[model samples]
Target: MKLKELAHSRTGDKGNISNVSLIVYHLEDYERLRQAVTAERVKNHFKDIVKGEVIRYELPKMGAMNFVMQEALGGGVTRSLSLDRHGKSLSSYLLEMEISLES
Candidate 1:
């Protein structure tokens, strides 16, 4: 199933960096989400877009995770020639991640 089945996402951008958050709809799925979604996976998912590194921060109590992707904004809003200067499309891509519950 896609991550959208279990969670929703939000995104923010700053100076070539993109911050993405994935919040599980149910607390029970938090663990599964954590296991299936890793920083490495996120980096791979956005391989063509993100150039630097993807760092993931876990918010276990909130059933959420935040991914800090560096060099991902094509140089940020003020300078980004990309259509998604704010990185909102990145949020949608993140939610599209395929999740394996068995993992």
Candidate 2:
């Protein structure tokens, strides 16, 4: 299944970094999301756009995960020439990631 089926996402950007949060709708899905959505996988998923490291902060209590992607904004919003300088669309891209839901 795609991550979108299990979760929704939000994105924020400062300088060249973009922080994307994946929030699950159900508490029961949290553990499964944690197991499948590793930092390495997220980094690989956005490798073309993200030039630096990807750091993930677990928020089990909120049934969510925050991914901090460095060098992802092309540059800071003011300086970047990219169409989506704030990287708002990045969250949508991340949600397109595929994951297996283990029974």
Candidate 3:
């Protein structure tokens, strides 16, 4: 199943950094997402777009994970030439991550 099936995301950018918040729809899904959505996994998932480090912060009470991606906005919103200057596409891109339903 795709990550989208279990979660939704929101993104924001500051300079060259991008922050993505992934929130699980149900409490039961939180553990599964916690196991699958590691900082390394997210970095690998956006390897081509994100040129720097990926840091993840877990919010167990909210059943959410926030990913901080450095050097990810092409350069920065003001300096970037990319169409999605704010990096909105990133959240959608992250949602494409595939995971095993049985896991």
Candidate 4:
């Protein structure tokens, strides 16, 4: 499945490092997301494309998650070429991700 299909919210540029925030509407879904998308797994998924580190942040208060991907664009901001046309596509991508709630 595509990364977008697994994320509740996602955002980033093509050539520059970016961060993708995800919000699991249901607690059950959050558990599934947590198990399905791991830092190592995510890194591996984008290993060929990204060149930096992939970090994950958990927010229990908001029941949300955040991913900070460094150098994923192949280069730093100075040399990266990735661009977000509307700056909102990332959220849409995240919403496309599908996961089952933990039982």
Candidate 5:
């Protein structure tokens, strides 16, 4: 299954960093999301765009997680020439990642 099936995402950016949040639709799915969506995996998933570290914050109480990706915006929004300078579409890209939901 795709990550999108389990959660929706939001994104924010500052300088060259993009912060993405994954909020699960239900609390019961949070643990599965945590186990499968590792920082390493996410870094690789956005390897072409993100050039720095991917740090993940666990927010179990909120059934959500936040990922901070550095060196992601081609320098910064105001300076970047990329079509999506603010990286608004990055959350959609992240949600495209495939995950296994095995019992």
Candidate 6:
């Protein structure tokens, strides 16, 4: 499975970096996402494709997980010219992720 299938992503441009914000719905599904798609997992997924920093943030209150992937757009909005693209389509890329339930 791919990360894109597990959550919704929002892509934005900041200076020369691309920021991807991922939100996971259904807390129960988090287990699947965590097990399959971890911080290092994601980094490896985009290692050759994207060149930047990948940060993961867990939001228990919202029952969602956010990922900030930097430098994924080749260079930035100005250089990558991918700002017009929608990040939602990337959901299919994270379908294999596994998340655990809160105790």
Return the lDDT, model 2, position 39: 96
Those runs of model 2 whose alpha carbons end farther than 4 Å from true positions after fitting are none
lDDT of 1 by residue, 1-103 (tens): 9999999999987789999999999999999889999999999999999999999999999999999999998888899899988888999999998878995
Candidate 3: C-alpha lDDT: 0.94
Clashing pairs in 1: none
Instruction: Write out the backbone clash pairs for model 5.
Output: none
Give the higher-lDDT candidate: 4 or 6.
4
Write the residue-wise lDDT of candidate 5 on 1-103 in tens digits: 9999989999999999999999999999999899999999999999999999999999999999999999999999889989999999999999999999785
* Candidate 2 local lDDT, 1-103, one digit each (tens): 8999999999999999999999999989999999999999999999999999999999999999999999999888998989999999999999999999775
TM-score of each: 0.96, 0.97, 0.96, 0.63, 0.97, 0.63
Q: Per-model C-alpha lDDT, please?
A: 0.94, 0.96, 0.94, 0.62, 0.96, 0.57
TM-score of 2: 0.97
Show the colliding residue pairs in model 2: none
Candidate 5 structure, TM-score to reference:
0.97
Q: Which stretches of candidate 1 lie over 4 Å from their true place?
A: none
All-Cα superposition RMSD per candidate: 0.8, 0.9, 0.9, 4.3, 0.8, 4.3
Worst 10 residues of 2 by lDDT: 94-103
Q: Considering every candidate listed, which one attains the maximal lDDT? A: 5
lDDT by residue (tens digit), candidate 6, 1-103: 3454556656555654444555666666666555555668777766765576777777655656666777666565456556434333334444444444334
lDDT of 3 at 84: 92
